[model samples]
Target: MVSSSPQTLILSRILTQNEAQPEAEAVLVEAGRVVAVGRREDMQAQFPKADTLDHRDLILTPGLCDAHIHLVAYGFSLTQLQLYGARSVAEIAARVGQRAANTPIGTWIQGGGFLMSELGLNDYPTAEMLDSVSLHHPVLLYSRDLHLAWANSLALRLAGVNENTPDPLSGRIVRPLGTLLENAAELVARAVPAPSGAQTLAAARAGANDLAARGYVSAHTMAYEGPEAPRALQTLAAQGELPLRIWACLPHQRLPEAAELLKTNSELFEFGGLKFFADGALGSRTAWLHPPGFADGSGTGIALDSPELIAALGREALELGLVPVTHAIGDRANTEVLNVYDGLRALARQKGLRLRVEHAQHLRPGDIPRFAGLTVSAQPIHLQGDAAMIGALLPQHQRTSYAFKSFKAAGALLAFGSDAPVARPDVRASFAAAVTRVADNGVRLAPNEALSVEETLWAFTRGPALAAGWTDEGMIQAGARAAFTLWDQVGHQARALVF
Candidate 1:
C-alpha cells in the first residue's frame, strides 16, 4: 500500500465545480494535496484513522482569489489618514491640517481615497489650498485611482516643478492647482525618501492579513509600486509569514532587471508576466476613448502607452515566456489592446501564456468576442459608484459600463477583485454588486447582466487561478491543493479552510 494511514476531510457539501454544477462529493486529502474524491463511505473506509472535519452544513469550494490588487500599497493605505468619505475640499483640507499639526516639520504627509467628481470642484485641485493647511509639511494626496495626485506648494517646490516646467511624456501637470497626472506624479513622488524596510514589511503583512481575514486565500498582486514592494512579499514568504499565496508582476520599466533576477529566482515566485498601461483611469478623465469621448467635453481622454509600444513589449515579454497584461478601461483603449493582442496570439499560444486585460470596464458591444481566450481582470464594486459618473461623463459608453455578463458569455475568463485602496475588498459587497447590478442610488445599471451565484463563485476562485496559471489550486478534485472556503450559504458569508 502507498501508506498505512491517510488524512481525510469530509464536508457535508463539497462543491466540485468540474461538473455541470457544484456537486456534493467527499474529498480525501493527504500530504497537502487531494488524494481522492467520491463518496463519504468510500473515503471513510479508505482512511480509518484519519481525522475528519465535520462540515455537513457548510458549502466547501475552492479558496477565493483576488485577480488584480496592489498588496503593499493597500497595506500602507490602511494605516494612513483615510479621506475616503470627505465630502468637500474644505473637509479634506481640515483633515490634512489636523494630521500635519501632529507630525513633525519636513515629514511627508500622505493620504488618499478622494474622488475627483465628488470634490465639488469641476477642475483639479491646486496646491494653494493644501499650502493653506501646512506650508511646512509636504502633502501628497492621491486620487482613488493613484493616477492623479494633489500636492501642496511646498512639495512642488521640493520637486523642482515650476510654472515654466514642461509636462513629461505621457503625464501632465494640471494648471492652477499643481496636480500631477499619470507619470507626472512620479516627478515629486520620486524625490521623497522611500519607506523604511521594516515599514514596508509591516505594510505588506497588514495588507495580506486583512485579505486573509476577508476569506481570500490568494491574490495576483499587480506591480504598481517600486521593486521593494515585491521584495517585502518575498521576505514574508521565506520567513513562512506569508498569509496569502501571492503571484506578483513587474512593470515594463523594470523588465530588464527582473529578467536578470529570473535567472536565479524563477521558482522563488513565477516571473513570467509583464504589466503595461494603455491609458489612465476614468475617475481622472484620463482614460483614452474614441471620438466624442466624454459628454462633458473633456476631450477624448489621455492615452498613456501607445499600441505600438504595447505590441513591441508584448513581443519582448512573449520571447521570455511571459504573459502581457494591459490596463484598458475606455473603448479606444480596449480596441487598441485587442489589436495588439491579436498580433501576438500565435506567439502567446506557443509560449502557453494567456494575455490579460485589467479593467475592461467599458467596451463596444461589437468587440465583446475579442476577449474570448483572454483574461478580464475586473472589479465589480467600481460599477456601483461609477454608474453615476458614467452617465454624467461618458454618456455614450454608459450602456456598456462594467459589462460582466457580456464578457462571461463571450468565453472570456472573468476574475473578480475589489481594487483595494480604491474600494473595499469586501466579498459581500462584490457579490452583491455582481449579482444585483444595482448602483449606489438603487438604480440597476445592467440588470440583465447579473451573474448567478455559482458563476460568481467560479470567478472568485477558478477564474483567478486560471488567470494566474495556478492549475494546482481553485478546484476541488484529486491532486488539487488542499485549500477551500466554507460558505454559510451559496451567496452568503465565507471563511477559509486550508489543509
Candidate 2:
C-alpha cells in the first residue's frame, strides 16, 4: 500500500519525460504534491526516517488524463442495454424483447450501441417491428454515434413525432421507423424526465471511478449533457469524493448561464472551455465534406453549426477566460473550423487560450498546419472501428484520418481521449491504435501517421493537461499533482493511483 504521509520515497527508473533516459530517483510527496525528485542516495541522506516505498522494476511516470469524455452519461449507459455486438436487426429485436419483458409497461426502454449499417436495414427500422413485440413500453435506442436515434411506435406517439412532424434545425427525421438525427433526437430526449440530483451524482461518481480504474488520473469532460453534470462533479469535489481532477466545458447555448456560474465559482473545478459542434458524424452520413461527398452519394453531407457562430462565441468566451472547443469530423468540417480558428488565433494568443478542435479526424493536406498552436483533442481508437466506414464513405480521407504524426509535425498540441458512450475509453486500446496504426480490418489506415509509445503517453498526459490549461497536473516533477498511473508497459496494463 502507498502511504499518504508527507514523506520521502525512492523509486527506481523514474521517467521524467523531461529527460531522455530514465533515472534512478527519489520522490518526496507532501500534501499530495511532489516536493522533490532527485537521486535516491541524496533523498535517503536528506530524510533517513521518512517512509519509503521502492518501485524497483516499475516505471514511474505522470498520471494519464483523458482530454474529452462524457461523464454521467457514459456511466449510466454502462448499465443500459448493450447492442454493440448485435449482428442483425433480428438480434437487436430479440434483445429489445428480452429487456421489454422484464421492464414495467408504459415506461421508455432506452439502450444504445447499434450501427445502422450492421442492422441489415437499408431503410430505418420503424416502430412496427418493436410494436410487434410490446407496444405497452416506448423504446428509443440510439445508434453508435448517438447522432441518430430509432424509436418504437409508442415512443414516437408519446413524443408527438409523426410523418407530418418537421425536422428541427440542423437535424433530420429519417422516414419510416421514426429515426431522429442530431437535435431532432433531443426532442424526444427532452420529453423524458431528467434524472434526479442523486442519480446524476451517482452516475458521475461511477464514471469517475470507472475511468480511474482504467488508469486515468484526471479528465476534461466535454459538456454535452446539461448543467447538472458539472454540478454533480462539483458536489463530489466538495465532499472529497472526487478521485480525479476534472476540467469541464459548457455548451455554447448555455454560455450566459455558464458565465454567471463562472463569475461566482471558477476554482470549484477548472471551468474554462466553451464547447461547440461544427458538424455531425459520419455514421449518419451527416458529416460535412468536400466535393464528391460519400461514395454512396449521401449528398455532400450535413453541416450543423456555422463557423461564424463558433468564432463569435469564441471571442466572447475568451473575454471570460474560456477556451473554444469545436467538434470537426469531416474534411469540410475541419476546413471550416480551421478558418474559424485562423480568425481567433491572435485573440487566443492574447487571452492565453489554446483553441481546441475535437475529433479533427478527416482533413485536407493543405489545412494541416493551420492547426498549429491549437489543441487537437482526438480519439485514435476510433480508427479501429471507423476503418470500414472510411473505406466505404471516405476513401479520400483514409490517408489523413486521425493523423497524429502529421498533426505533431505541424506543431499542433495533440491530446488523446476516448469519446466514451461513443467509444470505450480503454487506455491500452487507445495507445495501441496510436502507436500501431492498425484498424479492425487488419489493415493500417496510414502507416506514416503512427505515433511512438512515448508520444502517445504524452498525448494522454501532458498534451491534455496543456490543452485544458492545467499547470499543476500531468507531470512527474516538483509542484505537480500527486496523482500517478502505473503501467507494466505500453499496450499491456495500467492502473491509476491518487495520493
Best by lDDT: 1
Deviation (Å) of 493 in candidate 1: 2.4
TM-score of every candidate: 0.95, 0.96
Give the per-residue lDDT digits (tens) of candidate 1, residues 250-357.
Answer: 898877776675563432255557899999888898998898788887877879988998999889988886789899989999999999999999998898888899
The TM-score obtained by model 2 is 0.96
RMSD of 1: 2.6
Q: Would you list the C-alpha lDDT of every candidate in the order shown?
A: 0.84, 0.83
**Pick by TM-score: which candidate is best?**
2
Each candidate's root-mean-square deviation in Å? 2.6, 1.7
TM-score of 1: 0.95
